[model samples]
Target: MRTFNMHEAKTNLSKLIDETVNGGQPFVIAKAGKPLVKVVRIETEAEKPRRRIGFMKGQLKVPADFDTMGADEIADMFEGKSK
Candidate 1:
């Protein structure tokens, strides 16, 4: 991260933005010597990685009674039963 005062920030707005987006560098604009805002790249969907299906196959385990394991408890909760 880089810090720039208001005057410098205004003078180099375009360059700062370019550096932030292309060079993957971030910068902070300050007012009264206090940090104000940050400049950063907004990643588009295409730039993001897609999660592949079956990527975690066999990494998890399932019990034979998975479907019915929580059915009774859920029904009781819905029927106003408190335990």
Candidate 2:
């Protein structure tokens, strides 16, 4: 782990973050020669929650007129012709 003074860390924040993320090593930031904080990559793809597409596939049914099912009612409401 490399230690960076507060000034250095603030000056090259982007580069330091890149190195820490790519190299998989945590770096420390120090203030007045004392460690203040450590920066590390927290989550990788495997550690992140994945979005499961179609998780409920086949569990629900769609009617043939699904798209136009409410077309008339919505149009009537929009045109101030609701019953």
Candidate 3:
């Protein structure tokens, strides 16, 4: 990793970013000889595999009455009758 002072970093910001992105090399930016931040490239979505639909179709289950399970208490809360 190469170290770039504040001024040099600002002067070649785009070039540095390109090198990091294209060549996958990371560099450090410092101030007064003290390391401040590291610049690196983020992976694009294209590099990540996409999840297929219904990939876990049978991995989960829900009760048939799940929506109505909380009916009474939910209604009481809405009517300000539940504490």
lDDT of each: 0.89, 0.91, 0.91
lDDT by residue for model 1 over 15-82, one digit each (tens)?
88988888668899999999999888887776677889999899999899988998888999999997
**What lDDT score goes with residue 51 in model 1?**
85
Model 3 regions more than 4 Å off: 47-83
TM per candidate comes to 0.52, 0.53, 0.53
Q: Write the per-residue lDDT of candidate 3 for residues 1-83, one digit (tens) a residue.
A: 89999999999999999888897689999999999999988876666777899998999998999989989999999999956
| Model 2 lDDT per residue over 1-83, tens place | 89999999999999999987886589999999999998998784666778999999999999999989989999999999959
TM-score of 2: 0.53
Cα error of candidate 3 at position 39, Å = 0.5
Cα shift from native, residue 9, model 1 (Å): 0.5
RMSD of 2: 7.6
Each candidate structure's count of clashing pairs: 0, 0, 0
TM-score for candidate 1 = 0.52
State the local distance difference test value for candidate 1: 0.89
Better of 1 and 2 by lDDT: 2
